[model samples]
Target: MEKYMKNLTYESVLPFSEQVSYLNGQVASKTIAQNEALSLTLFAFDKGEEISTHESEGDALVIALDGTGEVTIDGNKHVLHAGQSIVMPARHPHAVFASERFKMFLIVVFPKKGD
Candidate 1:
């Protein structure tokens, strides 16, 4: 859902984890905000669920919020637990897997024209 807008303001503070819930045997996602330059998304994955390998045009930062997960980038694997984070470079092939029920925040930023 592309409902959240970049310039909107929230009236009250809310917990990010409570915004999305994990579904059994599936992965769930919520888009927190997005614009031409950046996007913010929250994801919840049940045990054994995964996002298949893919490439992105923008750099992405993955922040683990709960449980544990495995992130494979360019054929290398990294295990991440709560409070850990990793960056996936633009155009690199990457994938995400949940070792256990997990939640994470993903921030992706689009590169400007030229360098």
Candidate 2:
């Protein structure tokens, strides 16, 4: 068998939020997989930390794994808590802020090369 995931234990049960750890005043991330078609990442943010406005070529889905966070898309703000999720469309401006110590799982899907 081939492995498409990394930085994580295989064949085991685990919580996604536990994969990454929060820092005192920074954001920490763990990349589980990355390829042209998709990307999987886990993020932990300290209270008040943020990822400023940006645009991506792919659609990004954010799954709140722990605590609370703010997701701003197209200038509108949306709050997310544990067990919640939101999607930022491709080419749209978006940002993420930690309302408190927060953890999230991010999955991005890109268009195929010819599409």
Q: lDDT of each model, Cα atoms only? A: 0.91, 0.96
Error of 1 at 7 (Å): 13
Model 2 CA deviation exceeding 4 Å by range? none
Tens digits of per-residue lDDT for model 1, 1-115: 5445543346767776777899999999988787778889989999999999999889999999999999999999999999999999999999999999999999999988784
Worst 10-residue lDDT window for candidate 1 reads 1-10
**Candidate 1, which segments miss by more than 4 Å at Cα?**
1-9, 113-115
Candidate 2 lDDT trough over 10 residues, lowest sum: 11-20
TM-score of candidate 1 to 2 decimals: 0.89
Q: How do the predictions measure up, each by TM-score?
A: 0.89, 0.97
lDDT of 2 by residue, 61-112 (tens): 9999999999999999999999999999999999999999999999999989
Summed backbone clashes in each candidate are: 0, 0
